[model samples]
Target: MSFRTGKDFEFDPINGTNIIAREIGFKQTTFYNSTLTGTHKIDALGGFTVNWYGSFGILDQYIPLLQRLQYNQYTNLPGSPYLALISNGLSQKSGSVFYSTLSDYLYNAGGDISKSFTLFGQNKR
Candidate 1:
């Protein structure tokens, strides 16, 4: 979703009346996550009993631009600088916020083997 409105003065008063300056929202946002795991087991050379497992995973996200501006709650103003006018057009569709970006990756590997012999009540290894 996208909604853009013109007129951005957005508060620039330390004590000199406004000259016009604004900076809003995000310029860059980034994240990355990765994982890996493994397990293996082996027993008996002639009887043969073995188990194994493996896994891998990854995720990534990045945001380049998100622009929004609004200002109304700052007290203290004197007069010194003046030059403020904004015009580009107007927009209306107020409900706000809907932007997303995502990327993901995964990998897998596996192995297992087993062998056993039994009769009544006798087990020794």
Candidate 2:
């Protein structure tokens, strides 16, 4: 009639030059089901069934990089104050789901990136 769940994150600062980090977590639940009975057997299935599940994880080292770019002090360029810059990035993600009763499955994936834009009107002339 009741359930519990938990999660946690781990970090290792000694390995991989501390340039990366990893995380993991899990959850579980338990309950009784009265309708889960055999075919054409209502009185035969008089007990309750319990279901539960859980998960866990760990994290690697993480190291952040710092960089600085210098430009002509007098030139107020379009991307001044380092607010705008040419950046090319890509991302992708996929997932799926299934239904036992309907025997249905679904999946999806997509990613894209465009040129960076800056609100030039806000720049001080």
Report model 2's TM-score to 2 decimal places.
0.20
For every model shown, what is its TM-score relative to the native structure? Answer: 0.27, 0.20
Model 2: per-residue Cα lDDT over 1-125, one tens digit each? 12222211222223211111122223232332222212221223343233333333222322232222211211223433422111333211011111221122233333332222247655221
Across residues 28-72, which tens digit of lDDT does each residue of candidate 1 receive?
Answer: 334444444444344556566555565666666555444433322
In candidate 2, which residue pairs get closer than 3 Å at backbone N, Cα or C atoms, i.e. clash?
18-62, 18-63, 19-62, 19-63, 20-61, 20-62, 22-59, 22-60
lDDT of 1 at 75: 30
RMSD, each candidate, Å? 11.7, 30.3
Backbone clash count for every predicted candidate, in the order shown: 0, 8
Worst 10 residues of 2 by lDDT: 91-100
